[model samples]
Target: MVKCFETGAYVLNGREIVKDDAEAQAKLASMLGQSADKEAAKQGTMAYGVIQAHNHAEQGGLLKLKFDSLTAHDITYVGIIQTARASGMEKFPMPFVMTNCHNSLCAVGGTINEDDHKFALSAAQKYGGIYVPTNLAVIHSYNREMMAKPGNMILGSDSHTRYGALGTMAIGEGGGELAKQLLGKTYDLAKPEVIAVYLTGKPQPGVGPQDVALQIIGNVYNNGYVKNKVMEFIGDGIQNLSVDYRNGIDVMTTETTCLSSIWETDDQVKEYFLIHGREGDYKTLKPEAVAYYDGLVYVDLSAIKPTIAMPFHPSNIYTIEEFKANAAEIINYIEVEGRKQFDVPNLDINLRSKLRNGAFMVDQGIIAGCSGGTFENLTDAADIMRGGSTGNGTFTMSVYPGSQPINIELVRNGAMETFMSAGVIVREAFCGPCFGAGDTPANQEFSIRHATRNFPNREGSKPTDGQISYVALMDARSIAATAINGGKLTAATEIDVNFTRPKYTFNKSIYDFRVFNGIGKETPETELLMGPNIKDWPAMPNLTEDILLKVITYITDPVTTTDELIPSGETSSYRSNPIRLAEFTLGRKDPQFVPNAKVLQKLEVAREHGENPVELDASLAAIYDKIKSIDPEKVVDPKEIGIGSAVFANMPGDGSAREQAASCQKVLGTWANFAKQYATKRYRSNLINWGMLPFEVSGDPVFDKDDYVYIPNIRSAVLSGQPEIPAYVIGDEVKAFTVKLGSLSKEEREVIAAGCLINYYKVK
Candidate 1:
């Protein structure tokens, strides 16, 4: 259904794909000339203008920009403000906002949820930050309505911080990155590669922005097409899509593993800002005539169809049409893969069992989160469910509007009434379900959702506990169709319904009354509240002369995701408690990983205390004897070695922007990670933050489990700043291999040597 061209091609006008080498070059040259002609024809829309604005600023480049305005949701604000306070922040230099969306449910942590909300309110008053009380709006939705601006940069602690549809450049990073911004530290990085996401043609009917996004994600995610690159959306397609349509697609660029994104702006976007009462923020953006793109991704909107990603990955894509045609084969493949992931011998993998009569079936359908919770998506879903009941046989549906404004619109337009009449539950904005804390399914149940991911256990089932379930990603339209068919996986293409496009009337009054506006205010009287669950980072030591690592959990999969590293759902409550949360590291992937890692950690502690490594752990003595037999001169004293553990994965660090993946490993005394490659830049950053050495190993090494990999002068090697280092893996035989450290910033180097970013900051 999808065709990938080796040679770069351009869509001319929107219908023809220029693939011939000479024709492609000619088309590109013509397009460049047209751009120059347009620049001369218009007053704005030149890339040079945007660059000049930044150049005129005191500090150039995407600034370690301290926002004069700031906002965060409940799950992050408490920790963000607490970290700021610990780092000597007295008053808000920006308008910091705390919204209670993530923890709004208050189901997982008892009174702690309400306590966080109350603390946010008090902190707003005392520290001069904005506080939006509980259930006000989802974090991204509120920012879209009030905070985003053209040419301005916004950094959120949440991973879905995208505002490109509003002509704003926003980045979703770890809370520590946000804390650094609050404390006036520049978000340091070498300049990122810019990838042009050239769009053209109008999408076919029934194909929503989510469909287009999934298409692009399926094409780019596996091959790292745009990983760590800035995706600049440009082309004729910009005019074909509405503001909300573009927003839906823009938000999912995070799933493509790109670092940040921006779009070419037009009047529609300008009108959006003006309607929201921020016309002054509107500035059109376009690439220069001769602007260089490190790489290019060409997307034809018309070619995109209603798509679905099967369980376990967002990249496992197939069109709904193809899925219906090859149902049996697909079901069998899912079953086989499910057993591997679940590690169960006789687990039921046949979801086709739910296919009643001649229709494929599902247990639940969800339309929520930044991708699916838009007003148009929810309204259409409600329309499809107007007089239809999902039936009691296994099918259920729930709808969550992106924000309160959307909910109000739904109520005003009768969408809410339609949904309620159909027995569909309408929920307030909460991200728990998207991250696996809510709406858990029974074993072997299949769920179709419009949320962000479908990773194993991301839907909240404990596969290792024998409670296995799966999720499939689809657009809201298809999900509604499936629900209407009583859990059958029906494609929306088969449905005949008129979609009413409603003009969105944004209501700012809700935010005006409930949201605390702390812009241009500074207060120093804030006495920050410290929750018992919140604690400072533990002390970490510097790199030693020699390093020793045990293979705590060796995964041979092609890739290992952050979900596997520190999982979501109930485990999210322990994010602030590093030590307590560390117990779950690799818990699902390897049930014995925690104990195995802890045992290796004890040996490090023993060596630090000037004790013999052999005496500290009996297992080390056996490996030590084998190493000694190879080379007596290579024998190192216990004091000279720093014992830790490592895990081998084909590719690691995929999905989620959570830093706990690497932090949890650091807490468990993991010093290095051996992988063929890393999946995303954010996950790699997580590793750097935790001070773990992210090592790349090529081909198949002769090293086995319990083998000792010795690196001589490890501290000096890092201090000397070599890009690659040679090491010896000693087991039944000693084998030599090369490990690459990749590119590291000076600060990143120091952080690694000092053990972690937290230690670097504490010591600095």
Candidate 2:
């Protein structure tokens, strides 16, 4: 269904794909004049126009993007506003929308979530920002309905903040990026390569947006085909899809590990804006004739089927038919993978046991959040459930609309009534199912969901607490088809079905009534209402001359997501309190990490108070005694040197773009991270913004837990713009290694030198 180009390809207005490298280059050379170069050809891309419009880079090849607007959810807005407030921001310079969708349920944190919501309203009032009330709309939904515009750029704190299908280029990053925009600082990076996603043929009936997205993810995710690159869609097939169909595919582009995505806009996209009462926001967008792309992914939409991503990850995918062929083998592999992901006694995370006769059974079905809760997906689901029932044999289903407007339309069209009559519960707009806050399945049960992610412990299963449930990602169509079968696994395409094809009529009344439109209004006198759970960030010190770090834990997993770094579900409520949130760092992946990191933090904290920490931690005393023989001056003073802990991973930072993944480590005295390479740019940015050195080491894991790594004159090396810094791994003997800081903008260096982004602004 999806074919990836290993080499560069020439996309002729997005449809034709040339497989050969030499032929593509020759064609490009012929199209351009004799003076044409690769640099100039890159400008022909549609992404270039939007990126260039937002770029403020002094020199070419680098981008200093100032997004037209910014957005965040309850899980992220507090930290972003807090950082901006600390960095001397009085008012929002652009439209900053704070949506309360992630923590809207407030089931766990006892009034903590509500406290954050009130604080967001006050911040929107005082800082001049927009605020969406709880259960009104998901974060991306609000952005799509109000904030997105053609040729405009948007930076969001959530990883899935993609709106490229509507001619808007949206990039999701960590809180530090949003905080940068709040303070009028540029988001700096080298120009990302644009890969052409050439689509052809319309999707067959029963194949939804999630299926197309899963096909793309299954093709590109494991191979790193489009990692950190823009996937520009331009093809004749775009006109065949509805705006919502395109949106469903575009939003899931984050799972492909692509930087962002954009598609050629047509009347359907224009109508999308018109329906939302923002016709003025629509504009024509397409690639230039004979545009050059870094690579290409040619997708035949007609070949796509109802897809399924089995337990533990979204990338671990297989078609429903393919899974049914080797269910036992796949289930056994997932069981083994789950064992490695979850470390607990008697934690039986088994899907093989769920298998009955030759069919797999699921206990729950959920179609919720940005990827699943679209009007088209739900309408088709209701059609499949019509005159049928999701039998009450321990099998249940829930549907959540993306926004109140969508919810109202569903009710008006009778889709809600059909769903409820079929035993599928219809619910309000919430992002709970996507991030493990609502509709969690029972222990040892299997759930087929249409949510965005299915990461370990993502389904609200605390594997460490002896609770484990499996979640497999499937399209809403297939999920409903399975629902009608009494949870017996079935593909929607195989089952004859008809879609209602509901014409969307957007209702703006909900936003006008309940939402607080505070953007562009000045109310600086409004006081911020702080709850007891809301706490100030801990004071961070300047980077020390010589940094001492102990390798606390080594992660051998091929990839480490932000969910593993800092768990979601219940842990999201503590994001406002840095110290409290830090306690959960590596809480799921490695339970020993917090204690080890906190023990290392004690030395740094003690030294800040002018106390010798060698007496508090005897292990540090032994390391210093070893350092004494190496130092010519024999000066290992606690004040001049910073003590911290580090984690070594093959590749870290996938999944969510949560800053807590980095900030939590910073609060616990993490001075640096040693990795082969970071999975996403946002993860590395989060580390740098929190004053943690993002070190890329080429060698294998030569050190273990409690092993010391000493980097001398590290601060000076960073300020001097040295790309590669020398460091030593000290055990009984010293081993030398070189760590590379891949790329750092001028301001990024300043952020590191001053200990953090906040301190950088304070010092400036």
Best by TM-score: 2
Error of 2 at 712 (Å): 0.9
Model 1, 119-229: lDDT tens digits are: 777788777777777777878888888888777667776777888777677777766666666776656655566666778889876788888888888998888878877
User: Per-residue lDDT for 1-764 in model 2, tens only?
Assistant: 89988887666556665554656556655654432355666788999999989998876656999999999999999999999899899999999999999988888779999999999999999999899999999998889888889899999999999999988899999998899899998888888999999889999999889899989998899989899999999888888999888999999999988899988999998888899999998899988766678888888999998889997888888999999999989888888877876656678766777889878888999999888898888999999999889986899999999999999889999999999999988888899888888988899988898889998888988888888888889999999899998899989988998787989999898899999988778599999999889987889888888989999978888888888899998888888999998999998878999898888788889888888887787666777777766666867775678888998888999989999999999998888899999999989999999999999989686677778998888998988889888887889887778888988887888898888888988877
TM-score of 2: 0.97
Worst 10 residues of 1 by lDDT: 35-44
**Model 2: ten consecutive residues of lowest lDDT:** 28-37
C-alpha lDDT of all candidate models, in order:
0.75, 0.88
True-structure RMSD, every candidate: 3.7, 1.7
